[model samples]
Target: MSTETPTPFAARPGFVADEATGVAAHYGNPLSEQRDLAAGRALVEAGHRAVITVTGPDRLSWLDSLTSQSLKGLAPGQSSETLLLDPSGRVEHAAAVLDDGVTTWLIVEATEAEAFAQWLDRMRFLLRVEVAERPDVAVVGAFAGLQGVEALAPNGLPLVWEDGWGEVAEGGVAYADEPSHPARDWTYRETLVSRDALAELASSPVPAAGLLALEALRIAAWRPRLALEVDERSIPHELDWLRSAVHLDKGCYRGQETVAKVHNLGHPPRRLVMLHLDGSDNVLPAHGDTVSIAGTVAEAGDEGAGAPAREVGQVTSAAVHYELGPIALAVVKRSTPVDAGLVVDAQDTAVAAAQETIVPPSAGAAAGVPRMPRLGAVRR
Candidate 1:
């Protein structure tokens, strides 16, 4: 694995580089730009994400058959997300989906584009769907306010998938809203720009930002990214991703059975939480660092011999938001008390963390409303 990241924007002057999951961290001033972008006043390069195209008549239905979202009737220009899971319901891949009438676009981390395309190709099995990876189209990150970013109504608006996760979308339910949701103002979205057009866009006077700025806002909103936030044991419930990535009443798919079984009966083994890290040391914990409760193991489970607070979780995404300093997202054991004070082992020093529940311990048994069975299932 290459420890270095690719810098697509390095051609621009003042474009310093750092690694972020095999991609550039930022050009400069990630914190300041984060605030600007959060308020929808600026744009940032999302060179880390890649696009894959699925065409042919069977595109929508074929994709619906393989993933965890309702895509069969996806209208042209509609935005949604889907989870590709193993039969056991462990999250395998996540894509920000959008249909342009002629093709279905799968926006995923650059690292997974090729492999995920190969996986989809292997599953094509005589289906009319044609899977093709399109590195030609790049993702540019920004919010709603930035002018000239909207899609043209004539070309069906360039397949811009307005992020629906921050707000409740149709055929979904919310599990996080306590103490006020951080996504209340998260209008984050990504737009596809031609590789040739990037130089001009990057040179535009809008003022560029970096991944660090984006991460801060994303972590604050508790948004989970497939590259950094997931592991082999991850499931949708644990990250509270079902809000927009799932349709509880969708037709059968690969892991539908397990998806239903868990939400209805079994509780997720782990839960997602946002941590307010201690900034006293001016140190931040990186992803994969240990996150343990302050109390002893016996205090966590009353039976075992005394041990330093058991490792409850690992930091998945961490950042210093301009507004919320030193924040991170971690997946802790479901049994880890929400009110429990935790600490992050940042290499050598320990940093205190205040837990803000994203997925509560009682996060099972989904509450969905009566569905009057898809009347004619509107054709898109």
Candidate 2:
């Protein structure tokens, strides 16, 4: 659990609790709040996220050798993201990274902070680095260039982390082929502030958007969250995360080999897609809900039915967007046809799902080496 201080915004009028995230779900009108947030007229209390600080001269270099992104040369006030992967290249943890010359700040999900900090500390053998979790530090999120937020930073630097999600970072690669990806218009930022600053803002006139509003925007932008998008078998290629988080040409890190092999020789087993859910029933599919090709389930229920509907994928995140009635991000088998009409099983109702490709089925095999004929097989 998070060791962070409780958010003061919860006491505000119209606040509804989102226990899973430990933040206010909404301040009554989630749609209005989302509009305000996207227009840069509101700020969000992000106490559900935690801050971990790594200080000392060796911080950058030491971090560089452990994560997927190249970090040794990060400039002060620079923003980037890196993933800590298991030996076989499965995502274990993710953090939004920022450097302030004297310290490197890692903003991660609150639930993962303690373990993440402990793991980092254990890895610091003889390195001149000291890792510490800052429970007193809180996070505030808003659209980039929103005024007044930066002033709340305890230090002059603000320790702000501008998200690099939509654009491909240096040495990175992109799998999404849209002329303009939804994420390209996302200009989100997170600023670290002291607990006193959070209370000050809660009492201020600055408008507040809740987690519900933020989540709607995130879903519309097709941004993947670690807690939602990642699973035991997840890889960067599956979610098109290489666009921002993975530096394809970076020096060796823990999972570098698997990353290289998958990009060069094999395709990811699954791919991410956006689902425009049927909102006629006004029902939203929850995370882990079944997703399958339309008609499969209904057909299976007939008197002398065929095989039951096989789950092609599962919904990772879902939300009701102001402009887009209902939308979700799901990870499905890569071989599931891109043009196939899909459905989501929500509350025993078959909700039609229109598929929008985020990561294409042909998302890997970057090296593109020619295939050789199989033994005793005739060549076409």
Candidate 3:
């Protein structure tokens, strides 16, 4: 890791390198200019989804019964990741859930709201849970290095703060109208505040980073996000999602059968691994690039890389960090050689690469691979 510290921004958490500052200095025109705080924010809002809140007394028990993570024990101000699954154990939706004691808030991909809400509604038979979509809420994120900000949540998930960040608690749990920022999977609402105040609170003048930067940071930390790191055909074990989202000891849910069986007795069909792309040029392999190892290909498309352009795995997310160079998050078959040199066919050229395990083998990954754990798992 680079020992240099980043530059300081008033509201931003971490330091921005001089080079990074120069690259992001231009914000007015996105197309013709490099992205700055304003531009990055605009792009992030446009490209990514917002936060969705679910209110009512039955929220916790309701969501707990439907998702993989154990939410029954969630305190008033705690949060955690939850994975909704298909009957066969495939991932349907994943969200950062927040429990504000009375209500539960879910921060998820925008496109997933309708489907997830419908599913929740359909499942709400005699349960006390009331499922409604709260688009009125805004979602914001700050990098890990903010100084002097205290986090609101008890668990203090990484998504809540950067390395040096601290947070201030604005309101107590009982004050529904109090302004609150729940860390990681926790959610809170403030009806007393106007939209303007909410907007200002959510919109800081910090250097806004794109999904690309976020993706790079996420992949580096081994954190998996939906759509990019997960697929419908994939099981929770394959992505090591169980570590944070699935509670193995937790009671039953839709996919619990497969989750238990596969975990206790069988190996997952595939494994999530990180690839360090080699070669000089900055060309990043697209999401579906093929990976090759020892001239044999195992999986194809974005699911896995396949043959005669023989592939060992497929790139799910790839990025060139200002510091980490070119890196990727990929899912490869367990059969692929860990020590074997790998290559990615980015467009027409073959880029050399190395593979590391971010999620350990016991978490459904293959043995002897270097795995990076999800972000927040790191103890401060």
Candidate 4:
């Protein structure tokens, strides 16, 4: 493919919102656009929101022993999600770890590092491990048909790509693998590129997509993200996050007991579902909106005008898709009658909603193996 610079949004028939932010006006019905792989110019390195580096001879083994996922299998140039849990198994922080063979880099939410670092430090008495925060090494995101990779680490902050689908780097060098996967990161040496180079790279230009578009792609692909699908009360099973993150056979770690019990014997209380909204209405329900069965509205609006239009579930994240119209991902009580009609109140408008299960009923179902459950209520 030709590597010529892609057309900027300004040259296109879109309105510019402001000069400082450079946000483009998305007037065309978002639902009418095509859903396909984005192409064109590459993205710039805008520095990561948070960065944590783990060093020391016992780094790999130490981390493997503590995290919920199996870290032993990770090799250089690989990245995976791992969760840190309290003694009782509640998640403390979920992180994306990039292991480049020598050093392991963790990118996590901004608010999570202090607690995570303190926890790691508390566990690091005899082990030969070192944990440090490197705010100097900035993280950047790039898309488009970019080729080649290079790193500049004059200050010992090496930049490398964790490699999934797309090429990403800090200082011109690719870090990870091709076709970047969700939650991937690239590390680079801090000094390889100068301030001007960084600014120029940041201005390289790519489609300015908001979190909504990103969430839609993530939900459709069944990828788990924090705060949206994962909550303090949520178990990993509910989100189907185990596909790549959880290791059932791994040795005991914090919360492993609860994880095992829920996975093998008990059912998660709720399951994640994709909500296809009634596109004709153009109504998008806010998060935490009640979903109710059809025609169940109380007289005089006693239950709050939009009280979960049948209590099948609540929306976790929603966005008006340029192609899919108004789409939402929600968690519903798994025991809710699957065939029951569901609706959500979008302010004054009650929008018809349909729930499609994204996660199977049980882990046995997940493996394509058969397992029986106690029979419950049956509808005539």
The per-model lDDT (C-alpha) reads 0.82, 0.88, 0.57, 0.56
* Per-residue lDDT of model 2, residues 235-353, tens digit only: 99998888888888878898899999998899999999999999999999999999999767756457646757868999999999999989999999999999999999998988999
Q: List the residue pairs that clash in candidate 1.
A: none
Could you list the CA RMSD of all candidates, in the order they appear? 7.8, 2.0, 13.3, 9.1
Where is the poorest 10-residue window by lDDT in model 1? 1-10
Q: Please, what are the lDDT tens digits per residue for candidate 1 over residues 225-305?
A: 998889999988889888889888888888888888889877889999999999999999988999998755344456665
Q: What is the TM-score of each candidate against the true structure?
A: 0.89, 0.95, 0.69, 0.70
lDDT of 4 by residue, 1-380 (tens): 01132213334343333222233223132222213212312222322235678888788888889988777667775666678876666666777777766677777654566677878888899988889866544444333343322344443545543323123221111111224333332221111233334434434433333223344544544455565666777777676665545677778888888776766567677777777789787677877776766657654656665443346667787776555567787877867666656777778777887766665454322234366555895646
Segments in model 3 whose C-alpha atoms lie over 4 Å from true places: 1-47, 144-205, 294-307, 360-380
Task: Give the TM-score (vs. native) of candidate 4.
Answer: 0.70
lDDT of 1 at 222: 90
* List of clashing residue pairs for candidate 2: none
Worst 10 residues of 4 by lDDT: 168-177
Error of 2 at 63 (Å): 0.8
* Number of the candidate with higher TM-score, 1 or 2: 2
Give the poorly placed runs of model 2, Cα more than 4 Å off: 1-6, 151-155, 299-306, 374-380
